[model samples]
Target: MQGAQRNSLRLLQWMMAASLALPIALFAIASTISYNSTLDIADREIERTLDVAHEHALKVFETIDRSLAELNEVVRDLSDDTIRSREPALHKRLKQLADALPQLKSAWIFDANGKSLVNSLASPPPNQSFADRDYFYSHVDQSIGTFIGTVLTPRPPYQGARFFGVSRRRSSDDGSFIGVIQASVLPEYFESFYARIGSDPGSFFAMGRTDGVLLAQLPRLDRDFRLDPNGQVGRSIAAHPVHGLMTIAWPTDGLERRIGYRRVAGYPIYVSAGLETSAIRGRWLTTISQHLVFGLPATALLFILLAFAFRRTQHLQLEAAKRREAEEALKHSQRLEALGQLTGGVAHDFNNLLTVIRASVDLLNRPQLSEERRQRYITAIGEAVARAAKLTSQLLAFARRQTLKPEVFDVGERMRSLRDMLATLLGPAIEIVTQLPAEPCLVSADAGQFETAMINMATNARDAMQGKGRIVFTVHAATSVPDTLAHLSGSQTLKNPGFICVTVSDSGVGIPAGQLGRIFEPFFTTKQVGQGTGLGLSQVFGFARQSGGEVTVVSEVGQGSTFSLYLPRAPADLLPRSPAPTTAPAVAGSGMSVLVVEDNIELGNFAADGLTELGYSITLVDNATDALTELVSHADRFDVVFSDVVMPGMTGLDLAQAMCDRCISVPIVLTTGYSQALSQDGIAGFELVQKPYSIEELSGVLHRAARVKRVRDGAAE
Candidate 1:
C-alpha cells in the first residue's frame, strides 16, 4: 500500500509539472512567431517608403536629363563663339526650362574651354570657369552621355545654394568632346520634399550616388556625407545592383536602422528609406509584453491551483468524507428552502383571498342591509371564490403540473381575437399594436392556457411600463428553438419540425439584470407589496414548457422588456376540418342520475344540491373507492358518474379505470381544481370540467357524455 501511494504521488507531481510546462512552451512558440511577423511587417513598410522615394528621385532626374538633352540639341554643332553670339536667346530659353522645374536651381551651357557661355541665372552669362570642375573634366575625356557630379556649394563669383549637376556631353559629328549642357538640381529642394512626406522619428530618407556620395538627406548632415566603400550599404548595393533591404549603423548618428534601397533606372543615384532598428524592436517588444501581461498572470494562477490540488490530494480520503457530508447537508437545506418558499407563497395568496371572502360575508350578515347591498356582497363573495380557484390554477401551472387540453389552433387568429380584450384590460392609456404574419401560424397547445399566458405577460408588461406605453403582439414561424432556450429544449421535450413564436414586447421600465433570472420564481416579484402576486410570469413559463416549448425574456433597465413563448408548430391538417359541434345549454337534467364523488363534504353536498334542483337524482360519495363500489353494485341506476379527480384513496382516474376493468359501461365525468395525476396522465377519454364550474357547464358536460354513452349502448344492442 505504501509503495502504491508513493508511486501515485510521483505520478501526480509529474503530471502537474507537464501541465505547467506545456503552456509556457506554447506561449514561447507563439511569442517568437508573432515577433517575426512584426519584423517582417516593419521591413515591408520600409520597402514601400523606399519605393516612393525612388520614384520621386527618378522623376526629378528624368526632368533634368530631358532638359539637358533639349539644350544639347540646340548647340549640337555650334562653336563657343557662335553660342556666345546667341547667348541672349540661349540664356532666356535656359531660364525658361530651368524655371519650369521646381527642383532645378539653374541651367547652363559651357564651351570646350570650360567657360560658361550661357546661364539661366544671368542673361548675358557669367564669367565662370568650370574647367577644373569634375563634371566638365569627366565629359572632356570622351562622350560620357550623362555625367552626374558630386554636391558642391557655388564659388564666390557665382552666388547660389548648394546643388548637384546632371550634365550631358555635347559631342561633334566626328565624336569629339564638346562642352556639356548642364542642369543644376537643388539638394535643399529634395531635402524639403522629403520632410513633407511624413516619417517617424529616427526614420531617414536619402538620395545618394551608387558610388557612395550622399547628395541630399533628411536629418541633413553638417557637411557632405558618404558611405565607406566597403560598408554595409556599399556591399548590399554591389550584391543586389538595383534594389535590396539591409540593416546597418548609420555613419552620421551611429544608430542602427533597417533600410530599403533602390537605384534609379539610368542614374547613379540610389534612394533609401529606413526606420531605426531600436524603434522596430521596441514595437515588437510591446506586442510580446502585452501577451505576457495576460499570459504571465494566468500561468501563475494555474500554478497556484496546481499547488493547491497537490496539497488537497494528500488528504484525499479526508476531503472525500467531508464533501459527502457537506453535499448531503446542502441538499437537505435546499429542499427545506424550496418547501418554505412554496408554503409561504401558498399561505400568503390564499390568506388574501380568504380575507376578501371573510369581509364580504361579514358585510352580508348586516341586519339593516338593503337588498342592493346584500346582492353586491354576494357578488363579492362569488368573485373571491373564483379568484381563489384561479390562484390554485396558477400555482399548478407554475409547478408544470397543470392539466391542459391541447388543440391545433392558428396563433394569428387567436391574437386577432384578443385585441378587444387586451384593449379593455390595458385601458386607454396603453396602446396595443399587432404584427401578425400573412400566413397562419398554427401551434399545438391549450388555447385557453395560451390566452391566459398571454394575458399574464401583458399584465406584467403593463405593470412594468407603469401603464402608459405601447404593447406589441407579434406572431411568426420559427424553424428551430431560440438560443436562449436551446439548452432547456431537450429532444424528448421538443421533437417538433417547427415552432411558432408568440411574442409580447413592451416599452417600459425594464427588469434589472440581477433580477431577470429569478423573475420566474413563484414568489419572486420586483413590485412593491400588494402591487402583484408574482405568479404571473411563473404561469407563462410553466404553460410554455408544459406545451412542448419554452419561454424567454430579454430586457434592459429603463428601456423595455420582451417575452417570447415558443410552441410546437402544428400542421394545418391537425385542425379539425369542421368546427366541433358546440354543446347547447342543458337547462334541466331531465330525471337523469349522477354519482357525485368528492372528498370534501361541503363541495359534495353543494354539487348534490345543485344537481337535485336541476331535476337530477344525485348519489354522493366522498371517495373514488365508494364511487367504484356504487357503480359495480347499482351501476344501472347512474346515467353519469361525476367525480372530483383528487381524492384521499383511489383517484377519480383510477376509479374510472376500475369500472372499465369490470366492464362497467357508464359515462364518467371528472372534475378538479388541480391534480398532478391528471396533469401527467391526462383525462383518458373521459369528459373533464375544471373546478368552480358553473351549473350550466356541468350540465352540458353530463348531457354530452350520457348522450354519447346512450348512442354506443344502442349500437351494441
Candidate 2:
C-alpha cells in the first residue's frame, strides 16, 4: 500500500512539471510572433510616412521651378525695351512686373555697363557690379537666359537670404546686347511649400541641395535636435544597408532612441523616423519578468485544478474582454458623430447673424452724416465689421456654406499678381518659379477664392520647405480626365476636354503616405497646436467643389507632392471681365407710397422705417394675408406692393396672384432670404430680390417697380 501511494505522488509531480513547461513554451512562441508583427507594422508605418514627406518635397521643387520660369519670361519680355530712351517706361514696367510677380524678392534690370535701371527691393545693389556674377557672365556667354545659382543674403538694402537669378542679355530694338535683366526670388515664398511637405507630427522632413547642403527642414528642430546629416546620420544614409533601417542612438526624453532613415528619390533629401526601443518594449519585458516570478507557485498548484476547465475559462474571459473593447469603440464613434453635427449646426446659425450685421453697418453710412464724423464712424464700424466677417468666414468655411460666385479669369494674370507678395512672404531662402501660358486660358471660377486658395496652398508649401527650398506654380490645361475623377460630375465623358489645371508643387521634404488622405479634413492637421488651424485644405476643397471643379493631389515618399486644381472652362464671351460694382443706390422712396408686408414684426418695422427715411410713404403689416387685404381695400393708395416671399398665412407669390385676381394693377416685388418653392417659372411676372438687402438695393428694386406700375396705369387709361 505504501509503495502504491509513493508511485501516485511521483506521477502527480511529473504531471505538474509538464503542465508548467507547456505554458512556458506557448508564451515563448506568442512573444516571438507578437514582437515580429509589431516590428513589421512599425517598419511599414515609417516607410509610408517617409513616402508622403518625399512627395511633398517634390511639390515644393515643382512650385519653385514654375515661379522661376515665370520670372524668366518676364525678364525676356522686358529685354525688348531700349536701354537709355525707355528708362522711365522700363522703370514703370519693372515696378509693374515686381508687383505682378510677388514671389520675386527683388527684380532689377542691368545695363551692359552694369548700371541698374530698375530695382524693386529697398534699393538696387549699389553700383551694379553684377557683371562679375555667374548669372550675368553666363547670359553674356550663351546670349540666352540662364537660371543661375541662388543667392543667400544678397547685399542690402536687400536683406533677403534666398534668390534665384534668371538673367537674359537685354538688347536694344536693333537686337544688340545692352545689359542683363535679372530677377531674384526670396526664401519666404517657399515657406508655404515646406509647411505642407513636413507637416507630420512625430516626423521631420527636410530637403538638401545637390551638394548636400541643407536647404530646408520642416518643423525646424531645435538647434540640438537638428541633426547635421553630414555626420553620423548622413553616413548611415549613404551606406544604404539592407531593409533600409538604421537604428541610431540619440538622446530623447532622457533616454536614447534607435533612429531609422531613408533617402528620398529624385532629390537630395533624407528622411529619418525613430522611436526608442526601450520605450516600446519596456512594458512587455517587465510583464514577462513578473510572470516568471509568479510561475513557480502557479505551476505547483496546477495539478490540483481541472486543466480542461481552467483553459476553457481563460478563453471565455478573452472573448468577454474583446466584446467590451468593441462596445467602447462603438460608443466613441457615436460621440464623435454627435459632436460633428452640433458644430455644423452652430456654424450655420452664426452665418445668418453675420450677414445681418454686415448689411446694418452698410446702412449706417448714410450721406446725411458729416464727412469727418462719418469717416471716423466708418473706420470704427468697418474695422469691427471686418473682424466679424473674418470670424463668419471661418465658420462658413467650416460648414462649407460660404457663397462662391464663379466667374472667368485668367490664371496667368492672377499668378503674376501673387509673385511679388510671395517673394516678400517667403523671405530670402527659397526660390519661386512660375510657368504660365503666354495667351490667356480662362477658367470659370471665383478669382478671389482661387487666389486665396493659392495663398493657402502656398503657405502650406512654404511650411514644407522650412523657409529654404523652391516652390513652383505651373498653369497647364489637363489633356485627359484622370480615372479617379471619372465618377465626378462633368468629368465622365471628358475626352480631351481642355480644363485649366493650376499645379502648386514643391521640392521640400515630402508628406507621408498614411497622412495624405486626411489632410483636407477640417481640424485634421499634422501641425502642432497654435501652429495651424488645419482649415486651409478644407477651404480649398470647398472652394473647388463650389466652383464646379475638383482638386487632386499626387505624392510619393521623399519625392515631394503636387496639388492640382482643375477648373472648368468658361464661355468665350465671358472671358473678358468688367470691374465689380463697389457702390449701389440706396432704397429711397421718391415720395412713392409703398406697401410692406412681412411676418416678422421687427423686420417689418425696420423695412418701413428705412423706406420712410428714403422719402417714401410706408404702410407695414404682418403676413401676406393682411398685405393682400390692404392692397385690395386701398387700390390707388399704394403705388407698389413689396411683400416678403415667405409668410405665415400666405406666400408673397400667393398674395401677388390674389391681387391680380382682384384686377389690381399695382406692381409686386417679392423678397426673402430663402425661397425653395418659388421657382423662376413661378415668379416670372414678379420682380424677385434676395432678403437682408441694404436700403440702397431695396430702393433700387422699388424704383424699378414704380416705373413698371406707371407704365401699366398709362396703358389702362
- The top-ranked prediction according to lDDT is 1
TM-score per prediction, in order, is: 0.42, 0.36
Candidate 1 local lDDT, 1-717, one digit each (tens): 456656776777876787779877998898789879978998888887787788888888887888887788888868888988998998888888888899998888888888899999887866778888777888888777788888988876678799888888888888887777888889898888878773676678888887798888877884377788798778878999888888888888888888888889988788888888888888888898898898889888877877777778768845665765775565344334433444465566579778988998899887999999899888888787776776565445433523688988889988886675566567679999999998878888897788768877888898888989999999998756778667655663555557899889999989989998999876578889756656678778888889878899999988899998988887766765645544456568899999999999998898889888999999997988878878889989989999888887798888888988998989899998877777677788889998888777788889889999999989999
Instruction: State the weakest 10-residue window (summed lDDT) of model 1.
Output: 331-340
What TM-score does candidate 2 reach? 0.36
Which lDDT tens digits does candidate 2 get at residues 1-717?
A: 345545655555566667877877877986787676656655666677556655655554444445445534555545433443465655565666667655566567776766676666533235546676655666654466444343445755546456555455665567667677677754455445546543443344444443344444444432124445575555666676322675555422333444555555544445454445664466456556676677746765674463544455446556766755764564344334323433454455446545655664675656587677656656665555544444443333323323566767888887886674455446558689999998777887777678668867877787787767888999987776566556663542353245788999988678898998898876677777655557677768888878767888888767778899888765456668655563586855768999988888888888888889989999888888877777778879998888998877688888888888899988889887656566324576788776546677788888988998788778989
lDDT of 2 at 526: 79
Cα lDDT, all candidates = 0.81, 0.64
TM-score of 1: 0.42
Q: Which stretches of model 1 miss by more than 4 angstroms?
A: 1-20, 77-79, 196-198, 307-717
